[model samples]
Target: MSDTGRDSSVSSPEALRSSPPVPGMFTMVLHTHLPWLAHHGRWPVGEEWLYQSWATSYLPLMRAFNTLAAEGRENLVTLGMTPVVTAQLDDPYCLTGMHHWLANWELRAREATTRTSGEDTGFAAPEAMRAFGIREREDAARALDDFAVGWRHGGSPLLRRLVDAGTIELLGGPLAHPFQPLLNPRLREFALREGLADANARFAHTPGGIWAPECAYAPGMEHDYAAAGVTHFMVDGPSLHGDTALGRPVTDSGVTAFGRDLQVSYRVWSPKSGYPGHAAYRDFHTYDHVTGLKPARVTGRNVPSQEKAPYDAERADHAVDVHVADFVDVVRRRLISESERIGRPAHVVAAFDTELFGHWWHEGPLWLERVLRALPAAGIRVGTLTDAITDGFVGDAVDLPPGSWGSGKDWQVWSGEQVADLVALNAEVVDTALATVDKALDQAASTGSWAPRDTVADQILRETLLTVSSDWPFMVSKDTAAEYARYRAHLHAHATREIAGALASGRREHAQRLADGWNHADGLFGALDARRLPR
Candidate 1:
């Protein structure tokens, strides 16, 4: 999912399982993802991205989901966590790093309390700053406590608990969150297999579905889904030609493509005016540099950061109230309207990035909690993507055009002119990885003895996979962090070339040494088998 901006387990909703699928069924799908950030840069962009989302979004979202489950809400939402992000979430290194990050957060908040007054400091008033600091410190402490109880051993355990309890219908995905349409058939198959296997390995439960990266799709990709035993995936509304009343079976396959109802989704993410942009909500961008806290409301779109009004909890609360009511109304009205328009009951999916909640829109989780509650009260039925399909929401098949939920609802964002060089770089990397690994396996076969573990080949595949993540081109094209994106693409590509070259030169010792060094950073997918890279 895209932020355009931007959970623990509990009981399965067995209690709510019998609620008949009603018309106007709504599924709120959240795709939780971030590239592998460990050992990468920090500060402006890097591992901090993980920490910020973990503390602000993940923890709060988990609270919301758990609270709902505790209240007996099941089929709450369909969630997709890409394997790349899950790897970091489960890493011991990242768990330790996040603990320290939360500690620093509280320290920063406490330090901000020492300031005496605001005066004309271009920051909030001294009293306001002190209060903000105190509140932040408490938040940090609670977050730290949450981490200790649930995340001490890394996220897999918590996630597994949720899965086993039937709290969520986890979506299967590829290992690195690669944009599958662009990958070669073999690599695409490999990525999907590895991703699903990773899910099974981590949670011991294999998901039948996935939130396709970027909701990106192309014709016949459904075959790959079926081959990998993927039963369902998400696509954009336009991919289904705006008839998102139900999930469509793609091209005679059992794999279902659930189109995100943009009518419902864009309500929160609209570029022009979405709920998050409301003036009364806390602003996402403005900040108090010394305190590392956001103390301003979005007083106005054009308002200078310093001139923005101080964040008033009451004001933000009211905005949340209004927006929650408005969103509920929107979903209810859309469902009623679409059901009427289609002359039948309809299914609507409003999907987004999980970070958009606490990380981008501070009140998002509360707003979400309220909306989910209000929807059922208003007689609007809710279910997961699976529920919709099982409840007979499947519709006519669609020959999905090539598209993504990104900018143009097309592939340009990942393959446009600006990043042509990187695209070529990816092709080079993939082709070389296949050939090198294929050759090594062929030689091993001919010698009548299997190669001793092919560490070099494994590293080559790892670097190659990292090099082609859809994120790099996306960042470069969006100019959000273009330089960092370029540097990373080159970094992984360089690693792959050097190691592959060493292996090709019969210098097994040299290749093994290079692979060892790269493992410190890109080491992931321990079960990865270069032999899986078939012709």
Candidate 2:
């Protein structure tokens, strides 16, 4: 059965009620993240990442989720929010700023609605008013209100509500979205564990599944995930050799791993031909030359942003319906085909950055709303990783090789030329930090003191974390905001160098200054639990 394979006899809600329970299961995973942005940088690119995403993606998606739940429907989606993103969402400063942004957004929508109303006064074509109706303006107002409520609560409450309502399964990831395979083994373990700890503290639920940053995977990571109480994680399709079967626990480890389904995933978004490139979707690359904002259509090739017409919600909604219907159809067909081929139902995992829905693809939330509702109606059940595991449908085990869902689904993002310098610096910092930790442990054991070189230990720990931040390379590669990345890399490198110099020269004051600087930054992992670091 294709995603569109709803029985002709089961066309209505009443008909669906009589239909057999949708046996085909589909899982949607949304990974949400942005590096530490508080007091970090802004504008041209920084905290704006938070505000823009909040306005475009988080707010709308939360609204959609809540809307479904309000209808007494169970929304089965998986959300993977990194700790850094969570921190900013909950930060006092960000909450205040987000509230302001929501107000501004509401005003913008109001202004657009007013402008459209005025422009309609002299309208001649029946299609003109057909295009601009009271319902459309009301929808805009509803979208604004929904966004304001979600943003006002700062997302934490919305997240808690969703989890409590069983609308979605929450997945945890690294504290700051670091690519674990390239990081030091111990740091990798610490990052994953500390991330889980942070999520557990905030959400009041210890996540058993993690969205490994970039979907980057390595053989030994299972050990770390197991240690952190994570029972399963995701990787790219190639990582598990295109096996769409339910995930299999690694040998002798409690952790299970599932590979992404490229077939179904590419339908919604891909390097090319994804829904984002649709002629009707919002244009991401080109901004209005005068306003310095995105206010244009993704008019097909040859049509420039400056020439593109004002956004038309109806056109975009039609596109959303088509794409979402296509997505549901694809999943249904895959489920039926795989079931027949493998003699068992196969799980189709569609995973993507949470930002893609509303940020990159402006109509994404709308599409999500339709697609999620359409899945079950079409005889495909929505599920979480936990549901998949508990149902006993898991298939044969295969070695999941190292891979990430980045460009080429490989390690290029974390280890490419743009990030090579930071990688080298991280290597040096890791070595020195590890040696310092070992010495501290030795000294503490001998002296029976918990306060051996607190200043030095703190600096080393701070430098270690700063060096391992995943921001540098990501910025460099995307060229989205390279200057900030450079500044941050140097900031950490300088701190690490200063701490090392002070440690060498026995200059306690210099070391103290570096530790104080780090303390002020107040990065969540700066004071990582030393016990969590591997021996």
lDDT of 2 by residue, 170-199 (tens): 999877777788888877877777888888
TM-score of each: 0.94, 0.86
Best by TM-score: 1
Q: Quick one: RMSD of model 2?
A: 4.8
> Model 2: which residue pairs collide?
2-333, 3-328, 3-329, 4-329
Residue 279 error, candidate 2, Å: 2.0
- After TM-score superposition, what is the CA distance of residue 378 in candidate 2 from its true location, in Å? 0.7
Q: Model 2 Cα displacement at 85 (Å)?
A: 0.9
Residue-wise C-alpha lDDT for candidate 1, range 93-210, written one tens digit per residue: 9889999999999898888678686434365888877777787789889998998888888777777766666666788688787877888888888888888888899989898899
TM-score of 1: 0.94
List runs of model 1 lying over 4 Å from the truth: 1-22, 118-121, 449-452
- Backbone clash count, each prediction separately: 3, 4
